[model samples]
Target chain A: MKEATTSKIAWGWLALAAVFLVYPLVFQSAFFRDIGVLLLLAAISASAWNIVGGYAGQVSVGHGMFFGVGAYVPLMVFTHLGWPPLLGVPIAIVVVLVLSVIVGMPTFRLQGHYFSMATLAVAELIRLLVGTWDFAGAAIGLSGPAIPRGWWDLTFTSELPYYYIFLGVLATLLLVTWQVQRSRFGYYMRAVKAGERAAKSLGVPVRRTKLFALMLSAAFTSIAGSLYAIKTGFVDPESGFGILVSVQMLIIAALGGAGTLIGPLIGAIILIPLQTATNTWFGGGGSGLTYILYGGIIVLLARFEPGGLVELWNTYAPRRWRSGSHAP
Target chain B: MLLEAKNVAKHFGEFRAVADANLTVAEGDVIGLIGPNGAGKSTFFNCLAGDTEPTAGTILFDGQDVTNASTETHARLGIGRTFQVPATFEDMTILENVMVGAFMRHPGRADARAHAEKIIEMTGLREHAHLRARSLGTPGRKRLEIARVLATGPRLMLLDEALAGLTPGELQQAITLVRRIHETGVTLVIVEHIMEVIMTLTARVLVFNQGHVIASGKPQDVVKDPLVIEAYLGHGHGKRARKRGPAA
Candidate 1:
């Protein structure tokens, strides 16, 4: 009976994946394709953020530093050395590792709001540094060098190729998240989340576990940043390192369900369209209304349903048909 | 000695919580640590558990110095401790809570689960195995704490106020559980206020008063010591408090 339910959940996920896989193909519109790309991109970034923000319960507001690092590195390399944008992926991983250590080692030691404040400061510092650096184009920002449209350079003319590329990246990140959720690290993360003191007493190396989570989260977020840079073919410190960029990822995770595997993806699916619609209907002024609506929804969720939409789904959904086990 | 501490002291700024406290416990010994409120008993216990570093002293477990080891290191070194307020992982199921401890020895999830199941059974928490810890009452939470610590495979267990919030019936059951734990050959150092539970459960008693060891001996001898009596009551009210009992 348990196996039957498990398989049923598996099929449900596959069906969802199938829809996502062919979404752009069926819609056959540039606007729909753009939304699909942005949705998957946000899903990857939000899910990556969930590793530290949700599972470890460390609310990082400086993840934009990692994302900007990922975004800026490839664009900078392409402009200066005429290198392929894909090379930035590997370099971004190395940069994020060192950056995560620098940011996490000291900030992770602080508890609760202090940690968030520290991360916020670090993110702001990174943004200011990038905006002032001449090599990184200062505040003017840098765009990807016009290269021949090819897989090697990752500079495709059609939005379709970019869509598939991001889909692949999102799929890989989701797999990594799933593996993390099943590992011993997942258990330790939740343990630390619930009570750091008790987790340490039980022999969990609390600081190191948190650092590991941060490193993984930053690495994944950086990759998503690279993907975003390639998709847009432009990078600015504002778009890359802005606090809004970090907060948007956080909102998607929190709204969809921070800790659950599908939460961020679901969040992106609901939010990306809402954002696009508001920006289109209200033009430049509508962006404020969009953020206001998001802020209001977040407040409501925090007050009445702290676990976010996933909890609502779990509570209302049939017991037998619940998608996944809540156990660590 | 299974555990030995020499000149353990802990000071928080101008205040001294534990001053020059010394202790030694043999394998299979059950020692009750009893004292009045604000007597620094919990401070001394925290030092021994490596939850906090001693301001000055050395703690030797099985002849190895572990004075500044972290609490996680202390657990890995075969020391398990329960908290004063019963720190069960509130979100986890009771079985999952125990499994975290079991994971110390058996890193494999299946092995940890099997070991945790045995502990759940032993602690009589089998009925509540699937329940979240936050839903359990005080006694259940206490047992969950002990059961989790036991699953860590500790040679020495430090229990702080494990019997504080129990009903009389639950107190008796807890005593039986502690006795059962002692029977399993694990050394125990229990910090508790209930004089009756301490007297019946512990073979030796260590009494603390104002950051000092006032007395250390069998429960009856330690309880009757004049300084311990005075510490519990006032200097002139020893007779009144003594008549009420060693701890009331």
Candidate 2:
């Protein structure tokens, strides 16, 4: 039965990849391409956050710490030493993986609101430190060195390249999340999230599972950050490590369905379009309306449908069509 | 001994909850643990299940020291238990709740599911297999709790008030099921306020009073002891106790 499910999922991905490959070719436009890239990046980041916040029931508002570090470390290294973004990305990932442990060791002990607040405080501290610290270009931020227009540089002259890169990254992250959801570690995480006491009673190594989730979540979010920096070609303390960035990631996870595999993608689908439409209509005043819209959606969803859009679909839709159809 | 607790004690602040308790259970033994409220029966059970660490003494399971082990470790070591209040995975189905226990022994979900089906059938919860555990009635939930623990392949089962709030018919069925479970060679330690169920199910009994064991012997003998009757009926009712039949 697992073999059947795996084969079915593989076929589903094959179908999705076919659509992803053909869509850009048929409807090529710079604006659409840019939106696609942003949506993909948001999906990747939200999915990464879901591993810990959604699946493991650990809400973290310090994801920007990893994102900021992921963006800056590679760009900073490249700016000073002339290394390529390709090499810098992996280096950034490794750095964040190490940083996750340092941060997680203290914060994971705290549960619920305390954990969320602690993570937010740590993220805020990082933002403040980045703004004031001289080594990280001190608030002014750092830009990557100039590179010729080439595939190897990961720098392109157009949105098309970024769209494809992000699409690939988004696909990879989604696949990773799916794999994790099916693994023994994923079961441990779910057990912990259900009830720490019960999971411990069942012999689940709760702390170890949480640490693993946090580290994996940080690693993926860091990769998204590195990619964001590369695509944008510039980064600042506010833009990279802002509290709003963390909130946005969490909102995406919440709106999509948190623990579900496709939740972040669903969240990105709704949020990115809404943000783009608001920006087009309201212009500079649109930012406030965007928050109002997001807040309203969150409140309405949380109040009426705490499980988010994925849960709503599961409740109403036919289960046979879904990718993963485990018994309740 | 299949499970043993040696001089176990627990304290909350300055108050002693369970003091210097010793217990032993061999394979296929059905031991009834009885006491009034605040006698530390629940606390003692918690210590044995590793939900709360004993401040002093040791626990041995299948010959290894498991004193400070987590509840999960105890579970994996075939020490399955049911909570007094039926603590289940509420969001999951009744079958899924059982599957979680089954998963303790079977790593694969398919195998766990197969095992859970059998347990659910045994508990007579086949009709409610897909229903959420929270939706079940009290007796149904108790049965689900029992099934959940039984799915874990436990050699020793700890049941806390498993028959606390059951209809007489349900109680009879539960007793029969417990006997059947014992017939499968699983040792049972039952903490029950229902004297009739305890008398019918247990071969031996241990009485607790004020956080101490006051009596231990065959159920018929232990219940007839003066201290056991006084503990149950209160000191003032000692003269009136003669009007009632023997304690058993």
Q: Judging by TM-score against the true structure, name the best candidate.
A: 1
Candidate 2: global Cα-lDDT? Answer: 0.83
Top candidate by lDDT: 1
Clashes of each: 0, 5
Off by over 4 Å in 1: A1-8, A145-149, A316-328, B239-248
Residue-level lDDT tens digits of model 2 in B120-236: 988799978877776788898888878978888888889999898888898899899999999998999999999998889998888888888888889888877777788888995
Cα error of candidate 2 at position A150, Å: 3.3
Predicted candidate 1 versus true structure: per-residue lDDT over A238-261, tens digit per residue: 999998899888999999888878
User: What is the DockQ score, from 0 to 1, of model 1?
Assistant: 0.44
Report the C-alpha displacement of residue A302, candidate 2, in angstroms: 3.0
Which pairs of residues have clashing backbones in candidate 2? A200-B72, A201-B71, A201-B72, A202-B72, A203-B72
